[model samples]
Target chain A: MAPILEARHLSKRFRIPSVKRSTVREHVLGMLRPSSTEELVVLDDVSFSVERGETLGIMGRNGCGKSTLLKILSGIYMPDTGEVIARGPITPILELGVGWNPELDAIDNILLLGSVMGMSLKELRQATDEILAFAELERFANMKLQHYSSGMASRLAYAVAFRAVREILILDEIFAVGDAGFRERCESRFRELHSSGHTAIVVSHDPRTIKTFCDRALLVDRGHVVVQGDGLTVADAYTALLTHEPAAAAPTAALPEAVPAS
Target chain B: MADAPTRRHHWGGLVWTLVRTDFKARYHGTVGGFVWALLKPFTMFLVLLGVFSFIFASDPVYKRNLLLGLFLWDFFAEGTKVGIISMHQKGYLLTKTRFPSWIVVVTSASNAVITLAVFTVAIVGFLALTGRTPSPVELVLYLAYLVAALLIVAGISLAGSVLFLRYRDLNQVWDVVTQAGFFVAPIIYPLNILPERFHFYLYLWPPTAIIQFSRAVLVQHDIPTLRAHLMLLGMTAVVFTAGAAIYRRFAPRAVEYI
Candidate 1:
């Protein structure tokens, strides 16, 4: 099957400014030129592809470029060297409720949020009752979102995201939101959605989520993908990188052949 | 929300949504709130008319045209003032989402328009009460001038929003400009009273044409010539396009700066 999403030689860089609050005026005036701060490559030359109807997971330590990679894939940030070519609708939950207007009611936010995620207000109205009910916010739909608790925002955001007719979903650490019960509901929903042939790119350090749910996994470190293969091998290598430092990572053993051969 | 409706539809929907929210939140929680839009401009008109009418009664030009000119100037002043603060006030919306960002300026201008709408009704009523009923030609001229005033204020608002975004210091500069525009735009005094050399500046001012056209229609009951109409339209077009280009180039960066 043709890939639903592809990233070729993707890279991103950030320039840190040399100036600091402690820099004295005399020192600043002493030099005709401002110093160049170090350039940090947040996402190095990394490439990956997501085939249609596939579940892929990325496991890494903090600042492993997982979010950056997802951003490039979602077109939020253009890659420095390459492109993220996708074939279908992509919904990225990089930060849930990123566009919520506090003064507006949740219903209004639902309309705006749905639009940002590529749904029209007409389509949003169709899913309105389901979204509110899933978030357990039927009564509070008319209230301003500023009044919502953290968990409430998480629930509503998750409900709205999963409710869309998204061909590809990129989740960035948003699954950890809400309580254990909500997490279980989300996991079951993932199972149901996956069975319907939906594609998902989930970024998590959780071994259980990777080994159990992901058909394939990639281990990323310092903006580079070190290993890409079966769930068990990638997850074990990721765990090793965490427990031991990145320098101590042993060569990953072959994963079981029972998994889909990516 | 409907996936980029027709150009006319898309722009119109965006303007309406923003304008509605702008109108709502601005006066939210106050008693008899929206009425304040009408009351405020009306009060300014009465006060200024009283003060200026007494001071400049001997001058026929001032007595004839000052009210309409002052009314239009008030709209531009209030519109541009709010336009400067619009993106900052709605920082949450701008920082995260990208939709017709120009609507911020449009919404502020619309607020001014809404307030000015009431002033318009009062203008008609004032004329009737004073037995200065306008001819059909003059009535049509009022429409032309209304369109001109709206266009000028809206265009300046678009440019002002962009400048405020690029250079934050311009917020103070605009406050001074509105004050300056009020005195310099010939609101209190007619251009005839100013020396001929200075009168040239008035013709060059885009808003001055709007003010002059409005005064001619509302006070003198005369329609603008085809040349004057075309000039106002051309100026409106240039400012609107320039403002849009400036906004399109920098509005995305507004996310980082804002």
Candidate 2:
């Protein structure tokens, strides 16, 4: 089968005005002066694809455009130059608890965030008990989110998001939080998803996660893909790059291009 | 392209959830809960009625007309007022997820819609208490004009929501506009109090036309001319189309500015 998702030469550039003009008076006065804008290229001709039932890991330094690339793939940001072709619906957990209202209780938040993640109300209502159990917040289900600890909130966010996953899941730094037991549960759930043939694209800084969970991985530096190989090899390359230079420098010499999945 | 299915699947549920959450949050802690929605317009109506009663008391239908006009204006004013700030208030959701941006504006205006519905029922009740029941034809005509008013609100909101993201002071500007509009739209006084030439200019504003047309049909028992009906429809179409176009063009880049 053809790749489930593909990014063809995707590029994104954001224009930063020299001075912020957020009011009508400033905007009108701005017309009298010469306009100055600086364009920042967040993504530069990046290309990749994910096959059915495959887990792809994107490892990049801070501000290397991993999030931007994921935003484009998830349809949150429009690319300036290229296009993303997605054969399946994409559920992006770009951040946990994105729409969570602290004023609402756990059940209310599950309904709100679940719908935001593309789950129907019926499905959310049916799984509310299961979600609370998963998050280990059954006792605090009716308590307002404001009263819950940050960890509890993260767990609820993850539980609802996990249940709302569709044909393709795009997660950004999902494992950066949560306790040891919750992390273990998430790993087992991810394993179950992988075995069940759910395609996913995960972005993380941890090489162990990429090596242990990803089928293939790409190392990105300064908006360009530096290398693509098996999980372990690419993970090792990332670790070496990090050790050599804490801050990402110029892109290294060309390495192997992405190998098409058989 | 690939996200279309997910968006389409979640559109209705998402809109409903947002609107419901908004209502709950606004009223959840209050003792009266949903009663607050009705109480706002009614209190405003009572206050305005007392303040202007002596000036317009000569007119037999002044009370009913004032209540009706207040409800219509409240919908337009409150809807656009909240709708304009909705994009900025919901900016977090926009940046973090992928859904049609217009849903935010629609959800914001929904509170006004509900308030208007409840206020309309109150108006009918007040009419009955005063021993002047509106005819079915008049009621239907009034509803049509209310819908036209809603269209105008939706149009303003669509453009305002996005524009407000760029211009932070838009909400304050809208507040001043709405405050000025209450007097300009013939809500408290009869249209006949103004000169005939000024009447035409007033009718040019969509809200004036809506309020006048509704008063004519429902309270004054006077049917408006077909030309008046066509004018309201034309104005509604223009405002709604332009708003939708502006929203479509600017909403995509709204997140960048926000």
TM-score (all chains, Cα) for each model:
0.80, 0.93
Best by lDDT: 2
Question: Which digits, one per residue and each the tens of the lDDT, describe model 2 over residues B26-133?
Answer: 889454887877777779889988888988878888887888788788888889998899888877678766777898887888878888887778777877788878
Clashes of each: 0, 0
lDDT (Cα atoms) of all candidates against the true structure: 0.71, 0.82
Which stretches of model 2 miss by more than 4 angstroms?
A245-262, B1-3, B6-10, B29-31
What stretches of model 1 exceed 4 Å from their correct place?
A19-38, A245-262, B1-16, B29-31, B59-67, B82-100, B103-108, B125-166, B252-258
The residue pairs found clashing in candidate 1 are none
Which residue pairs show collisions in model 2? none
Write candidate 1's Cα lDDT for B76-180 as tens digits: 788778877677665655543334566666777777887777777877888889898777788777777777666666666666676665456566777776777
Q: What's the CA error at residue A249 for candidate 1, in Å? A: 6.1
**lDDT tens digits by residue: candidate 1, A1-262:** 6688888888777555465322234344647766645466767678888888898999887876787788667665556677767777776675665556677778877765665555656667899999998778899999988898877876888888889646777887646878787788888888888999999999887888888888998988777888899898888888778778675364442322232211
User: What is the DockQ for all candidates, taken in turn?
Assistant: 0.17, 0.53
